[model samples]
Target chain A: MLHELQSGFMAAVLTGSQTELTSVTPKIREGKLNTAQRVAIYRRNVQSTLRGALGDIFPTTRWMLGDDKFLNVGDQFILHAPSTSGDLNQFGRSFPEFLSAMQPSAAADMAALDWAWHEAFHAAEQAALDLSRLGAVPAEQHAALVFQLHPSARLIGSAYPLLELWQAHQNSEEAPLEISKILPADHHFLAVHRDDANVTLTPLSAPQFHFLKICAEHQPLGEAAEAAFALDANFALQAFLIQTVQQNIVIDFNEPS
Target chain B: MSPHHQSSRPPHALDPLCAGIGLRPPHYQALLGKPAAVGFLEIHSENFFGAGGPPRRYLDKFREDYAISAHGVGLSLGSADRLNPAHLENLKKLIDWLQPSLVSDHLCWVGVNGRYLNDLLPIPYTEESLKHVASHIRQTQDYLSRQMLVENVSSYLEFADSTIPEWDFLREVAQQTGCGILLDVNNIYVNSINHGFDAMQYLDAMQGADIGEIHLAGFQDTGEILIDTHGAAVSDAVWALYASAINRFGAIPTLIEWDTDIPTLDVLLAEAEKANVMLEQASFAMPTREGRRHAT
Candidate 1:
């Protein structure tokens, strides 16, 4: 009996249809509000709540889709991408991917960037290893030095210049954003991370992205720099190292661990 | 390591006799420099479950000043599906760090079958559900190594086969499982208005010994039904019900929860001040069932 009520009720909620509610209908009391209206409240709550969550977590997506379109997209995302976790923050991890397939508005690209920001906002805090400490290491060890990305840092690659697109949309003083008109036609690489709880999205050169990606993969510095050099002959290993260390991108490096 | 991880025990005990207000972000910056005169602070468990960042930092600092209660909207304590071990683990990790005075979630299920509905969906008031929910509570309490108070959810619909009343099911869950209650007065009032039950009777029905906390919030009337939006000030009827609840249960830790359209901390503290006044002005402020338990 419990199984019937639960499955039936859940079906009604997910489908927004009353077909399966017959068995559960008798249990509802005859009150000022009828059974369907009562069930409709739950259905609406589920939609509105999840939609509200997606909007909060992925505001850039909402902005791209506009209010109604985002909600419409949100509903479809709901039907296809069921929230698997109890945390509302954890609800929309798949939304960006879902949007990527659902619409052509490039909302998915923005969603992905937005999601990265959200994750970086919550990622663990780790103090980047001191550059002077690395410099203190013997020059011979420089090749073996493997830099670790800050725990809060994430690298994202996009066909669209998501960081610029995101910036333009964020500019309240700028004219109302039209993605096609303003977004530069270029592939973009960026890193998202939190410094003192301020989540930032900083653009990265292809060489920088490769270097960091390889290092983040736990490769030795020799190999990581080689990967960067492959991407750009003028990878500027010395200067990049200084910039990354100051940015706290490379934290607590050690021998192969 | 996270600053919270540095602590082995909570800074202090949550005084279960004062008023608290929900802590949201808009008021976070102001509270940092000049916190309101709130008796304690309450927060949704998931809000702080982030790996580590500013939210954690603020909460770590806030814990030093006031007792904290980890009120959870997730955990889906009554889901038919096995309780999410990951959810429990995250909460356990948080408890280890925050060491809140009390830990609680709704006496409702939010998800099932690997699909998280994310809203507190009503559970049927039946023996089968009672057993399921009780077993889940036992598992949670055992795993958490602490008591968990479950609050009732305001519902829009009722089950026809429900032989037991909501008040009875809630009381039975506490009685059988040895758990505590976080009686939400606004939920009671909202349910009373929607389901045609006497709010006073609902309060009178709860065993005083079982109630560990009291929740006060506002509701929205969409002309047809009252929704527990938690976006407004406590309605007059809810205040009246709370007064009745105070009479039956005596002074307990009451929280003024405003989730959406959150006002200034001044506004939140004002609502909490009202609850504090009720706590002080209670004619039945004498120790009831719970007070005796504490005494002996």
Candidate 2:
């Protein structure tokens, strides 16, 4: 009975369906406010709280779409895809995909990048790669070693220059770059990660991005390097490896199984 | 009643007489490196639920200077559905790492049927709901190997099928589960106005109850009803009620909670200072008992 009551109440608040309200309204007491008004308060609370959470997580996307449009989309998203986790941080993972489905735009790409930054911000802290361990491994056997990115590291590919867009919105003193001025690119690869306190977004070249992507798939160093070389003949694997390690991107490694 | 296991790490004890403030992210930098004026800092447990990030990193730094209270918002302990195991695991991990002086969540449910509404929704006051919530609390206390305090939530509506008073329901839940009560004085005042109940009666019911901590927050009077917004200062009426609570319950650890429209750290400390004044007055007016009481 409690389950039925809660299910009916949740359904009414989330969807505002007449049938669900019929099950819940009779069980709610009416005072200064009528039963419909009382239930409406909950409906407003549920909508605003979840909408506020999305706005917090995707402020840039909200800004891009403006308040009215963003609120509308957020409400629709809340109705269509209610949160599944008690943790609010775990909510809104699929907003980008939802936005893309509703209407593809630069805002959806920005949402993807925003989600990545969010994930990186909360991702697990891991130790940097042990230089000594790598040093002891024979140079001839280095090709067979499979490297892993930091747990906080996320590789995001988008058609828009998301980092610039995010940076532009961050500085309030300067006017935000007009979305109309920016054009879609062939591809934009970025590595979003948290190194200590800062969550940094690093732009990556086609070759470097593919190399890291391959490495993430648990490919051996030799194979990853070959893929990068395929993307560009002069791909600098040694330099990129040094930079990756220095930036705390590639955190651990294991011998290929 | 269930027995609680010893904490893996020794937790920093909060001075129960001194008032504390909620640790919001905006104040993280300003409160850092400075000696906190409050006795402890209360954090929403779900905020630090992330594996490792700025939230945990900052809490680690602040832990050195202030006692910590892990006030969770996402447990949905009163839901008819089963307790979220992942949520419990994450909460346990945070507790183990922080070793907070106090742990608390609401008596309200935030979700049902695996779909989280993410707001503190009210549950009916009845025998069945009481038993369900008590069992959930027992399960939680068992899993974490530590006793937890359950707070009363501010509600806009009351169920018609309710048999027990909200105060009685809360007290019975505490009695049944051997848990402490995180008495939100503001919620009592707000609900009193919203539901047309005597505020003094609510406090009277809580007399001799396991009142672990007191929360003082602001509310919005929307002409028709008072909403527990926690976005402003401690209202004059709520402050008066808090004084009465201290008189009745003695000097419990009180916290100033301001979630929305968060002001400067100095402003929050000022609010904490106000609660501290009441707590101090209570200590002097009455013979103070040992503030710390084990739930079991």
Candidate 3:
């Protein structure tokens, strides 16, 4: 009896179709509330719960799109996506992707950037770089050295002036901020990490960015350095490496080729 | 590292007699060097779901001084999809590392297809949901190789198609799965008030032996609705219901949860102290009533 009832109720909740309820059990309508109303309540509850998750993950995106439209997108996301975790903290991984494909008036790139940044904020904590190993390496092999970014670090590049735009939006009420002054035609690199229990983001240079990327890929030291140089010939390998090392951005090291 | 290494397992710190508080970020610093006595601490497992960081580091220090319970918020036990393997792996890792006294999750599903709602959404109290939830719980226990306490969530709505009462559904789940019950007395009280069910009757229907833990938290009576916000002190009426619960299930390990609008650590400790007093009174208050009733 328990099995039969759970299946029928799940069927109704899953499909939101009156026919499913009737087919599973005719007694669904016998309660104080009709089957439709009960199922509607569940539907409302489910959507609202999903909405709350999206709101948390994409606060900026929701702010960009009005609440009503944000809710409409939320409803669509719920229909397309079902929750997989019991934890609300883990709920919005796919939301940025959902917003990218969504027809909302906001720029897709802006939404995607916001989502990436949010993920970096919630990403796991890891130990800072090991300085002793890298310091032992010979200066002659410095160019061959590649740096590994912390596991929690993420590098995001956006075509839109997303970094500047995001900053401008935050300062909108206090004073009018202009993105045109800071906007660059070339892509801008952003590094994300948790510092002091807070997620921090800062722009990165070509050498620093590529070096970390290669290390993240776990490419050996020699190969990672080559990649960094490929991104920019004047990569200033020593200068950036010193700054990254001091910042404790690298968690581990390898032999200088 | 595998969780089954017996030598590495941490000893349990939970005391059967005292009350504990759920540890949150707001109170981390306050709890760091406090001399006050707290039975143990419980945390939302997902809060430390990240691979490593300050949260894990702080929890490690806290565990050294206080017993810990890992209460999970994301193990969607009732979902029909095969249990999430990634989620299971993460949980397994946490249990192995933390070695908490009690590992618990809700008897609810928040995700339907793939995206997670993150809230403890209601599961229909029908045999199908029951069997599915039970089998999932059994599998979870088998994987973890430990009995998990499944807590009931507060629900604002019930399915018109639900064939069994919520308590019965809960009972069948615990009985069939061989999992212990983490009875959230506050949730029961809130549901009872919202759904117009007799809280005592619900308590009467439960199997006392299977109950492993009790949760007490305040609710939001938003005038139009009663939400289980867990944001304030437990209400007077809810405390009465809790006192009744103690009469039925003597001296279960109780936790005071304050998630939103969380107050000071002292305030939570004070609230937990209140639960401890009630817990003591319940045990002492019981034999007298039992003897009087038998005299009749």
Candidate 4:
């Protein structure tokens, strides 16, 4: 009865197909409304509830899609994804992935950035690696020292300027997003991280993203710098390391741990 | 840490005599600037389930000055596919960290077979179903290592196959599991209008020692049936029932829940004030309603 009752209602609500309602429809009394109307109430609630979740998680995506298309995309996603968590915040983890196929232009880029922000918001807190802590280490150990990114660190790359698009949503002075104005080759490497205290998204050059990404992968300082230099021989590893530590992106480091 | 809790945070006591309002995001700035003149604060537990951030920060700040109640919106306790271990783990983590005065979720299941609806779906009130839900409640209590309350959800429709009334199902769950009842007065009123059951009878059936917390929230009248929106002011009918519920249960800890379309903090405080006044009136208005044993 549990499988029969829940699956039927879920199918009816998620797909708007009445075929599955046969098992539970007769159980509902039609005093003021018929079976369809009664089920319609739940149908509407489920849609609005799930759609509202996606809206909260991806406000930038909502700004891009407006009310109608965002909802339509959400409706289709809800049917396929079927939020597995009881937590509403955890419902749309796969929505950004689903947006890749969305019509009226896919929001894959913006959704990716928003998903990064969403994850960073809930990521665990850890103390940032202090440069002074590294100062005590012998200069010879610098390359072997493994600098780690914060637990919430995420490096997102996009062909479109998603960081710009997402940042534009925050400013009151910027013109409303015109997707048409967005160029495909506007390559962006955005560093999204939640330090123990704050969450931020900052643009980085390709070399910078790769360097930090390699460092985030637990690569030693030397290897990470070499990888960044591979993109461009003149990559400023010292300046990048100083700025990252200041931003608390490069938190703790270990000596061959 | 004790088996009842996994975290090292100490337990905080909640004053059952004081009525509080749901602390929402809209009210955070004001409340954080200066703690509101209310008894305590109530928040949707899931809202603070995040690992860290402003929700985490604000909740910690609020806990400094006020007692907190974690009213969970998810959990889907009655889901036939067994209690979600992840959801339970998150909840226990929160309880361990926050050490809230009280914790509660719904009597209805949110999803089944591993797919969550995220909405409180109605469950059939039958002997078999009753046993199923009760077992989940018992399991939850054991895992959480403390007694928690189960709330009665507002449903627009009822199943014809239900052999028992919702009130009986709720009461039986309390009796069988020893979990407290968070009797939602507005839900009873809304359910009465929608399903044509007597709200007072629902209230009367809930007169027990297990009745611990009371929730008062607004609902929308959808022309055909009432919807528990919790976005408006508590209706006159629900207040009247609160008066009755107070006489029946006696000055239980009441919470004003405003989830959506949240008005200003003043409006919410005013609603809390109203509940406080009714609570005051109930203290002296009528004799103790018999058969109502409150778990102090």
RMSD of each: 2.5, 3.8, 5.4, 3.3
Query: What is the C-alpha lDDT profile of model 1 across B1-296, one tens digit per residue?
Result: 45636577644655555689888999888787865378788989998888688888889888888889999988888788889998999998888888898899999988888788889988888899999999999999999999999999999888777889999999999998999999999999999988988877777678888888999999999987899999999999899988888866677889999988999888988898888777766634665544422231
- lDDT for residue B46 in candidate 3, whole number 0-100: 81
Question: What ranking of all candidate models by lDDT puts the best one first?
Answer: 2, 1, 4, 3
The DockQ scores of all candidates, in the order shown, are: 0.66, 0.57, 0.31, 0.55
Q: For residues A1-257, what per-residue lDDT tens digits would candidate 1 score against the true structure?
A: 66566767777787776576665678677688888888888888898888888889997777766788888878888888878989888988888878767653456788888898888877777766666787688888789877788888888877777776678678853433665554445667998877666888879988898888888898889999898888888889999888877777777788643
Q: Candidate 1, residue B9: CA error in Å?
A: 3.3
TM of chain B vs. native, candidate 1: 0.94
- Summarize candidate 3's per-residue lDDT along A5-51 as a digit string, tens digits: 44555556656776875664454443444556655656555666667
- Give candidate 4 regions above 4 Å deviation: A102-106, A173-177, A195-197, B1-10, B285-296
What DockQ class does candidate 3 belong to?
A: acceptable
User: A142 in model 4: Cα distance from truth in Å?
Assistant: 3.0
For all predicted structures, in order, the TM-scores are: 0.94, 0.95, 0.81, 0.94
Model 1, runs deviating above 4 Å = A21-24, A103-105, A173-177, A180-184, B1-4, B283-296
List model 2 lDDT by residue over B142-218, tens digit each.
Answer: 99988899999999999988999999999999988999999999999999999999999998888555988999999
Which prediction has the highest TM-score against the true structure?
2
Docking category of candidate 4: medium
